[model samples]
Target: MKKLILLLLVFPFFVIAQDLPTVYPFISEGAKYIDREASIALEINILERDISTGNIDSNLLDFGLEVFEYYNKYGAISEDVYFEYLEQSEYGDSWLSCIVPDYVSSTLKSQGNNSYNKSNLGDRDPRTAWVEGADGYGIGEYIEMRVYAEALKDLRILNGYQKSIKSWKDNSRVKSFKVYINNVPVRILELEDRMGEQIISFDDLLPEGFDIWSAEDFEIKLEILAVYPGERWKDVCISGISFFGCYC
Candidate 1:
């Protein structure tokens, strides 16, 4: 009887421990041991103030909630590194706008006056998206960007047309992306078909002995390998792409 009770008590813990990697692959296993509640709370407060004063839109608020959800579900350590990255922004050591790529790939001319340019990928507005202009579902199409890789930590992607629920359902979303850093193939990211931001960590992929303070730059490319077909259109869309890191 005592053995049965012990097994019942330990089963859920074992399950969760095994499931963390599958659930939040962006969070490094090493970072799952550090606590950063105070830092996370501070960022939450800043986000709240920004949202209230109209300084920033509610997208950041939703981001904060997602971060809080990570903290809640995986405990304090799960998001400690992320919040640590955010803390640098407070002291001017980092800035959010720095995540915007210096240059983005060209868009197709057939997009017309709707302005479906590649620049929309980093505009921070979910309503806008970068649509691939290619024949037959744009299977081999890709988008590339150039950015300083000094403090780059993680990349966040908002998949599909996010202008409206109807639009999202009508446009294709990426299922697999072959990631390249400085033209060197690095990782293949598998994204979910659902809405909202998907984060991919670059911590483990950085070059050995890399220094964040250095001024090295890299060209990142995301080549679409597969997609979640849309209901109405064959266009594959991506709403936003942002990074989190420390510039200091």
Candidate 2:
């Protein structure tokens, strides 16, 4: 009888520990929610305040309750008061998070090892690359990705065939290029003959006078207009590529 009573008493602690709701990943949006439970009011209030001031270290007591001060605009700030959270300003999911390789293509193939083909561009590994094989460093050679994004805001390119620190500058790097969406020319970008990743960001990818969002079914083309070839090789290469914003 005593053992049964002790087990019942100990079970609640285990349950509490296991069920403490993680108070993270809350979308930063000014949205309100209502709950029937009064015990949770204080916890919500404290968390809401901390997050607003860029404070993430809000304490959750042993009771597994986040300590936050609730403020009620309509009535007394009580446990039953409705709460609001930060609203998300940015639209769409992360571009890199959910992108699928639609049609990542390059000009030619490396005859010896197909591993360095254009298909490897979306693999996210910098070691493998989309390299123009025996074709040599052709200025017009390009690496085009058929991107599908909700709102394309940022484009990051790990330029060059960077298998090693020494090999990074050993290939033709993109010096000037044109950006295309769905085969429609949008903008042209010129990058320095530099090693490492380069980013092209857009505040509003939508065309002028359009408020909705950018096109989702996009054919993003990175046509090599000019290049700075490496010391030894004359091959054009792109190591990695990633887009930002939500995927369609």
Candidate 3:
């Protein structure tokens, strides 16, 4: 019986290991040192094709790309890019804007005199919020939105209740969020306890060969993994969420 149980546990791990691609073995020492960009690009194309044909798992590809990106010291999208786009938008640059999602929904919503529905997340108002109705700190709750993926580059979130300083302090805030793109776990966004907008760039996280300009619309879900407890309230709140992208 002991041996049978051990085999059962080890069998699953063996299957998982088989499912993951051997991405590193494909890169030669010469390719890594001689023409890294060209080599990586070629491998990415081949991997993408295999993924599309169901020959390789998408998650495995993501893991492989992340390893390469880390070794290459590729950085996430910078605030400067966001600021530059903002400046251009002021001068009739209609190509880019804060995208309001086509649909927004939450697992639970707190009932109150004022509305605390999912719609509040995209209203662009820090004063209003989507509060989780769950008991305690509302861990494990989630909010999801669907938006056009074309040129989608960044995600902006205003964490916690922001009606007033008092309100912000009275309600709980998200400390970490597990972000999922189209139901595949992508990144975990760790937020500061302080009040302000937090930006998350997709530049480093998106799967290789995913053309944001041509892909169909996709869903993004943010699951609350942890929270900064409030002094007075058990409910957790998020003031707003906005997507930065170019329509063209």
Q: Choose the strongest candidate by lDDT.
A: 1
Give lDDT for model 1.
0.64
lDDT by residue for model 2 (35-91), tens: 213324555566556545647533222222222333323323343232222111123
Tens-digit per-residue lDDT, 1-248, candidate 3? 99999999999876653343211111112211123234334555564455445675444444344332332353332333323323332322123343444444442544566788777776545577888887789888887777677767777777788776677788999988766678766566677775566666667545556676777887877778899999899889887777666444
lDDT of 1 by residue, 1-248 (tens): 99999999999776643332211234222221212334345656675455345675444454454444454565443334444435333434555542445544445554555667777776656667888888767776777777676677777787888777788888898888766667765556777776657777676544445554574777878788789999998889888788777665
Candidate 1 pairs with clashing backbones:
none
Which regions in candidate 2 have their CA more than 4 angstroms from the true location? 1-114, 134-136, 204-214, 246-248
Clashes of 2: 11
Clashes of each: 0, 11, 0
Estimate TM-scores for all models.
0.59, 0.53, 0.59
Ranking by lDDT: 1, 3, 2
TM-score sort, best first: 1, 3, 2
